[model samples]
Target: MLELKEITKIIGDKIILRNFSLALAPGESVAVIGPNGAGKSTFFKLAAGLMQPTSGEILLNGEQIKKKTHLLKKRIGYLGHESFLYSALTPLENLRFYGKLYKVKNIEEKGMELLKAVGLHYFKDIPIRSFSRGMIQRLAIARVLLTEPDFLLLDEPHTGLDQEAVSLLNLLIKERQEKGIAILLISHDFEQVIQVCERVLILNKGRVVEDKSIDHQRGLMPFKNWYEAAVSGK
Candidate 1:
């Protein structure tokens, strides 16, 4: 479980986020949609323990996550615009490094499983610098899963993925949700996102404007309507 309490972020005279708050429980997946500069990534960074919030706190379980590096590493997995991979290292080497960091028991087997799942098995020995954007994204995704954290903060995770990779990502999300993994998804692909996330949070100007359940029964119309209406209202 994760909770954000009255979170605020300010730099200079500009307020990046204003009283933003959220609570996520096991097996819950929430998708956040907002225009650029809505503080979505900032929220993810704060939740992932990448950056400390200027006000309030982010709590994992019952404890504040500030300065709790080990707990954060064990409980939260984050994938943002940055790949966070070493360009000089091969996919296998990169995975091995993370495996050591997480103290993964079966690093070899786990790395192979992940590489195959992400369609990178054949390229395991290729340095990350030689990979395409989509390939880099795939490896980054694998890296995130290596830890199998309780919560996932994925910001624009589908940015450079192809349809096949997109489907794989969706399947991964579905599998995680089924196993009680909490997910915070940020994506523009509403059709694909609705299939994985049960709820949607519409944010505007760093504040949540709408919070509602997604109706996947109707396919994409419900989300399209909701998003269009929300943006038009502003």
Candidate 2:
């Protein structure tokens, strides 16, 4: 459902991404892991059409993303490292605003459902400025779900989340995957990554050095071993 072909991104004199490529099929969940400065966020920005690659192209479905942004925006949901919430707006107001932007049907009902799902129903009328980091994160998740996107790009979505919020995040990921949403997420939480994604891609120095499928039967040990080996150049 999403494809990046031979993408290279350079900023100033430094290269951030070099000939990077990846594809996500419908209903598939992929996790990207790497050390700091591995260009994971840059890759997400390229895919989301928030920034252009110096070379290569990003496609959603069959159309090039840069050339079809307006049409593609409705089909994709992106959650970045920051919550990007309007602090002055109430949770209900925030969802209603985005829901209207996406032209979502029954926005009021849908907004309430999402607020409840993210455990923010009680705070629906409260402005986000008073919320704690985790609460804002939960409300952000609710905001992203307002459009029911077909493709999800999440960058460190687990940031500021507690164990309960993380559990809710996992459940939402599973539900979206079951509904045939294509997902690409960057995360350092190995345990949660194992629970949510079917495949893992290890990016190093702007390149995908290893792509491995999770072996659920063997558990996290195998993934840890593989990641260590890959990063250590084993």
Best by TM-score: 2
* lDDT, candidate 2, 111-224, per-residue tens: 999998888999888999999988998888888888999889899999778899899998988998899998888999888888888899999989899997888777888888
Tens-digit lDDT track for model 1 on 1-234? 899999999867878899998999999999998888888888887787777888998887878888876787678888888999999999999999988988888999989999998889999988989888888988998998888889988888987788888888888878877889999999887876787788899888889999988877888876687788897674
- For each of the candidates, the C-alpha root-mean-square deviation to the true structure, in angstroms, is 1.6, 1.3
Scored against the true structure, residue 20 in model 2 reaches a CA lDDT of 94
Cα-based lDDT at residue 110, candidate 2 = 93
Number of the top lDDT candidate:
2
TM-score of each: 0.93, 0.96
Q: How many clashes show up in model 2? A: 0
What TM-score does candidate 1 get on C-alpha atoms? 0.93
- What's the C-alpha lDDT at position 135 in model 1? 89
User: Candidate 1 — which pairs collide?
Assistant: none
